[model samples]
Target chain A: MSQTDVRMDGSAETRADREATPGSAGGRRERLVTHRERADSYYGRPVLNEPTWKDHDIAAYLFLGGLAGASSTLAAAAELTGRPGLARASKVGALGALGGSLYCLIHDLGRPERFLNMLRVFKVTSPMSVGTWILTGYGPQAGAAAATDMTGLFPGLGRAATVGAGLAGTALATYTAALISDTAVPVWHEAYREMPFLFAGSAAASAGGLGMLAAPLAEAAPARRAALLGTAVECVAASRMERRLGPVGEPLRRSRLLRLGEALSLAGALAGVTVARRSRVAAMAAGAALLAGSACTRFGIFHAGMESANDPKYTVQPQRRRLAKKRAERELA
Target chain B: MKRNVGKVVEYLPFLGIVAVICTTSWLAGRSSLAGRPSLVRTPVRR
Candidate 1:
């Protein structure tokens, strides 16, 4: 391996140059130039620390939280519309997804008490704090609804719990966008305006996928509609976010996982629109694809943010652009 | 009277959750606008 000496001024000297220098230590004379003119940080190091969040744990947490929140809302709607089978399936899915989400969060925190400690204070500026409280509000209602539905007990109370969970569920579905975007991560923070809509749409798509997977074919029309609508919104919001971010969006655009997610979402939407309504097997396949797509999107976004945080150019270029724009405005004034 | 008390006890958890929601919402609204007096506009000079 060739060693390059990184200078404090963000320039690098190749091993060939070092060997050519008089009185330098011995090395092979290979005239390989690797340095290029671009935005760089001190010693070519990252300008910001990448988040320490474990990849699978936090990404799973995001996907499951969205699934749970949207499922709860879907459950409430189904119950109101008198679709018992869909309601029951959605309620149970919400509870299970919530359990998984909480587990992932607690696992990432390293302790259950640490997760609870987040509720010690609620600050409007702190998305994590608000999200913690939102989860606290949402969890029990989802659990009660699911338990009551499964056990056939407390019919009246179950309905109430479903409604309550539905109300909190909307916030749960979208607050995660705020949670991620509130960070200094370039990809996430720069896309803050569209992040919530993207997350909401992903959540809806996943919940619709779950409904179509578990519910009776006759009662799956709403799920089909939701899957299509959510896919459209998610696609539009994601593209808009990328367009608005320009060069800063490079990480997202370059992510293979994001590309796979978009392809899978589009395929699932097409399947749902065409053959899913006519065949149970097709519906199940489409539902699974949609669920996988939503998961991929969450993981893709998380990884893209990590990539942006670790790269000096992603940080430096955006800041320089902003400064340049401000200077131009000042000049015009 | 005993039945009413029992009923209240049964709904206690729900009530607690509601109270927390209300309190947090109020606090969040207040904190978001903390030190932002300009949001409350002064009357225009006639």
Candidate 2:
């Protein structure tokens, strides 16, 4: 990682000046400081690295994983409640989404084969490691459940597998929060407290949307309920994250895509609740809108973090303040 | 009535999944801005 000298205004100072000159800061000191030591480092480029993962591969993967996990749970619920139509649709949906998620995950790796290597170790502190294990269990269980549902064979084994998938699905739906927040990304890491609930709600909304699109309106009542519940939880958690974030929350507020996503999701949920029973067209529209909204939310969050990572001010100032606060507290103690 | 419902069920989720994913990827790709380097001298307001 070569450090290019950048001016306070984001302009490149020179193509080959490795040394900081006195006149560079408009006559400030010319002392050589590591990127960390230059209290004025914010006057330059990014102090932290941007995410290397492709947006489609990783961000889309997050959304799909959530959808699949929730759908698996919905399948289990539908089975237990005697809604064969919903059960069949949700089982198939879960299996398909899980397949999509794996495709994105493997493709996102620099070396596709490294995906297999990810399974070589398990760490309690590592969300990625945990997620790898969860997906391993979830894939087979969801595949079996959907296969049995489709083929009309082995009812007993299908039921057992569906139950197991539900348990694994819960972990799958929520662990992405831990995965991202465990990073140093300001918005994601700072949102550690609310991300799980936000993800859980997003998952529900996605599953509900799929349910609305795939099952009969009468039999899809539970999916509608889940949609409403999930949207409410997601909205509340997101609002709280913004409020708690204060200045750091600027990234969340700045992404237009995020705002559009939230609006579309809420609108879809309202439509689902108010008019889904009255018209199939309305149900389908609401389903599409909600699914689109969930996608927007994930992409919005991804972009906002990249924006934060690109700005040195976002990285340097927060840490500096935190360190100062700790120093003051230590002196007092 | 059940047949109509099945027709919608059979097709839309597959289509919706594909549509949602493509839309997401497009938006993600479009929103990316080149990273800028500059001195940001804002006072920490905590």
Best by lDDT: 1
Model 2 C-alpha lDDT per residue in residues A1-333, reported as the tens digit of each score: 224443655445443444544355434546686656567356588877888976777887888999999988988998899876677777777887887888778877867679789889999899999999999989999989877876669999999988888778889999998999999888888899999998999889988888887766656888898888988998899889988987777888888988888898899899999998779789878987888888788878888888877877667767888999999999999
Off by over 4 Å in 2: A1-41, B1-17, B20-46
Supply DockQ values for each candidate. 0.01, 0.02
Q: Which stretches of candidate 1 lie over 4 Å from their true place?
A: A1-40, B1-46
How high is the DockQ of candidate 2? 0.02
Chain B TM-score, all predictions listed? 0.66, 0.52
Model 2 has how many clashing residue pairs? 9
Candidate 1 global lDDT: 0.81
lDDT of 1 by residue, A69-155 (tens): 988898899899977666777787788788778877887899999987888898989999999999999999999998897777999
In model 2, residue pairs whose N, Cα or C atoms come closer than 3 Å (at least 3 residues apart or on different chains), thus clashing, are A8-B39, A10-B37, A42-B39, A42-B40, A43-B38, A43-B39, A44-B38, A44-B39, A45-B37
What fnat does each of the candidate structures reach? 0.00, 0.02
Best by TM-score: 2
Q: Give the TM-score comparing model 2 with the true structure, all chains together.
A: 0.79
